[model samples]
Target: MSINDHRLVQCNEKDEETLLIFKKGINDSYNGKISTWSTKKDCCAWEGVSCDNITGRVTELDLKQHFLEGEMNMSILKLEFLSYLDLSFNEFDVIRIPSIQDNITHTSNLLYLDLSFNSYVSSLSLAWLSAHSSLKYLNLSGIDLHKETNLLQAVNTLPSLLELHLSECNLNNFITNPFMEYLNLSSLLTLDLSKNNFSSQLPNQFFNQTKDLTYLDLSWNNIHGSIPHSWKNMKYLDYINLWSNKLSGEALVHLSGWKQLRIMNLGENEFSGTIPINMSQILKVVILRANQFEGNIPTQIFNLSYLFHLDLADNKLSGSIPKSVYNLTQMIKFTMNDRTMAVVELFTKGQEYEVQQIETNRQTIDLSANYLSGEVPSELFHLVQLQTLNLSRNNLIGTIPKIIGGMKNLESLDLSNNKLCGEIPQSMSLLNFLEYLNISYNNFNGKIPTGTQLQSFNASSYIGNPKLCGAPLENCNIKEQNPKTPTTSMKNEDGDSIRESLYLGMGVGFAAGFWGICGSLFLIRKWRHAYFRFVDGVGDKLNVTLMVKLNRFH
Candidate 1:
């Protein structure tokens, strides 16, 4: 055989035997995944295997989520040239986690290892991990690490580690050694210790050495107390989530130093005091809901040009919504192309929804369940791209603005449980995309506006407003006044009788006067003759006076 043929033949012998051994350990049901792993073909051509082009040695094995059921065979580490190995998300019945001490020489070339989500691996001892000094990425998430005592210290030995995920590992021992103040993994960029039983104050200096960390999630833990001032050194942080913890105090003042921060979630905590005023301007998501924050929503928040999701719900905040909310130019026009911005829990459509991927046009402003008062700002309607607007459970008053229809993208709206009144604006019916609406328990009056979208809601949406009527409610009716008894009808008849009596009395007085003058003269003949003789004598006296004057003038 020629030299090239001899080299190719030599590369396939040992590694191929090791791979066939790894395959035999798994149940026969998953044979299809490695069906091509036969002695006839070179091992480098097998499925889920990659070999270095020149050396013809297997370098990567990726069988993630293949549902291969079997006990882990530690002999796979015998792939001396392997650099990457992922056997995650499989039904491994038992895992004999490797202690690098037993096979140090075989694992020196390994760089990436992911054995995450193998729940059957009940116990872990990371002391063995210190042997893999060249390891960079390690994910043991969803594995039971309660029995592991040296998790932090062993992980710290990995100087080249860039990302570590131990979430849902039931890790309760936060600091195994009180003297170990800071982690030694200075090259780490991402760390997720969430969904663990970390019931202690945030270690003051635990993160001091990881100044380059850009993402940190300690959410879903019992971690209490204020954020340590030492954390301000992590200026490169881009996202931090401490949600569903007992963390408290007004120490958010330290957040202003994180100029690179973009997303912050402290929801469901005991955090009190006003929201920090000097928040980073480039922040895209701010979720401080269900806390003890009391005070006006700082007007400075509206100045954040890139803010798209602002949730201050279920706080004690008081005061009118700032009219400056219209200044959210990004929410009005800008499209957030990054779909993985942040996972948010929002109260919209009268319920809480855990949103995993915020769509490009999904802008939300949730200020519900506060002591806020004043008319809903008309200027707020300028956010035409907004999808969820929840201003419910407040003291808001006045009519819904006609411009509300301009927010055409609204999918969930709640103006319920307020003092808002007047006809639900006809413009509101123009919101064709509206899916969930609640205007109940308000002073609103007039027919609920007509539209398939508006009328599609249940009558409960229009309840508590006695005067609000239309489809989805009782029709408007004009009620007439009724007389209680005949007395009221008789009063009308008595008015007519008084008018007839007054006319009769006036006729009698005129007839009596006529009889007293002419009738008496006719009846009494002697008095009549005296009246006529007196009349004739006056007439003759006037005629004689006129003749005497005429004769004198002539």
Candidate 2:
């Protein structure tokens, strides 16, 4: 054979030959269009190159984000000393796909391999990587593997895999036998399969199989059904997100098993019933909105000492503001929207006033469009970092609190469709960050608050009160002569009362009027009879005198 081949065959080559193999592999990535170095010695001087501190052997090749391009070189694949290889995010794209048939056979010492976020990696299979006997870390996320066969077979090759990320890989169908056959990721600590189309209900034995899983995300899928009771067995699980699915049923209880859990997003589901009491203590960012849940606000739920964002909007929850909620001192975002199944819209429902140390970190609270009646809770002003306050579409009465101006960072305020009376608070104008304000459909009667922000608000923001006169309405602005005039009030009231009394007296005196008419007629009849009788007598007397004269004549 050749002289170098003789030296390699005899095991007489120097230690520098191993690094040359890696350098040559770097050259293959450019397809001979570019060099790995300006001069030959720069290959050893590369940033991520690591020679074993003992053997001077090139054991690591980490060229992350170095603007490298094209398929990995076949000539450099002959390196047998590489232990850690990370070629992630280096603009890897090629017109023609590369084949590893010859390259994978030569380089055999590779353990940790990461080729993530590259466009060139479209179709992958475990069979292709079957020869990598020592691989432990394999991250192929953001690679867009469309078909199943490529990845299913490829992932089964690494027996010592400790970390694997197949997120956003478009994998949904039931992964069968040969796919998971050799895949025993017992050492795996993190597995992210998020945003995939995996619709099948996960096997109940899933968590039981993965005892070491720490951070797992199966979120943004179509997986439904109740949270498995065995889910708590994943003792090492910390970050779990199954959000944006079709899951239903009551809240998962005793999340204490996942006591270290940091981020949990179970929102956008059909989960019904009350929020579980104990889960509040373990969560940091809890999102459970747009579900079918109902019942009273659990007082202990507000005790989540680490809550930063809590979203439970569009669920059927009731009761007034429990002063216990202020215990979530770090809460920055909280929403309770459009489900009026509550008793008191505000605090008048005799909310037990146990004001915990209010966390000035709260940025948003939305309890809008609920059956929440009574007055708006004055305790709401305790949220100094409040950014958005939406309490619209409730039976809430009373005046808008002037203390709202204390929320200097408030950007949106919506108090529409309430029974609130009194004038719009001029203190509202002090909110410099307020961009959207809707306070319509209230009984507030007084002068419209005037300022640059107030003037910009249209008349629609101040509708629904007839007594509210001095607005932009042309007829309402001109001062009237009748300023709470007394004469008009007395006349209107007296005339109304007199008409009512006359109708009542007419109905009651109907019999009296009839008897008076009948008695008067009877008296008149008697008088007529007596007068006629007198006349007849006078006539008779005259006639008698005539008759006597006539009789005497006869």
- Residue-level lDDT of model 2, residues 1-554, one tens digit each, is 11121121222134345445434534344433335333444333445665554444556767777667655543343456777878787666532223545444564787888877766667554454666767777777667676655565566566677777776677776333334534556677777777777776666555565777776767677888887777867777766667677887774563657667766666667877766666625555565656777766666766675664455555676666455336655543444321211111121111212121222243445565455667776666656556666777767787877887777777767788878898767887788877777777888776766567665666776667665654452235444423556887799899999999999999769867886766565679876677779889999999999999999998
Q: How many angstroms is residue 503 displaced in model 2 relative to the true structure, after the best TM-score fit?
A: 27
- TM-scores, in order shown? 0.79, 0.64
Model 2: runs farther than 4 Å from truth?
1-37, 44-114, 119-121, 128-137, 150-162, 174-183, 254-256, 331-374, 390-399, 412-422, 435-554
User: Model 1 scores what on Cα lDDT?
Assistant: 0.81
Worst 10 residues of 1 by lDDT: 1-10
State the lDDT of candidate 1 residue by residue for 1-554, as single tens digits.
Answer: 11233234335567877888788777647556665567786667676887776877777888888777877776687788888989898878677655546464654677899988876778766666776778888888898988777777788789999888888999777644564575675788888888897888877666876788688888889988888888878888988888899999885777878889888888999998887778887888888988999989888888788888888999999999888655676678866466654556766667777775665566889999999999887778888888889999999998888899898889999888999998888888999998898889999887777889898989988899987888889877653123236797688789889988999988998899998888989999998999999999999999999999999999
Separately for all candidates shown, the number of backbone clashes (residues 3 or more apart, or on different chains) is: 0, 11
What is residue 27's positional error in candidate 1, in angstroms? 3.2
lDDT to native, each model: 0.81, 0.62
Using lDDT as the measure, the top candidate is 1
Evaluate model 2: give its lDDT: 0.62
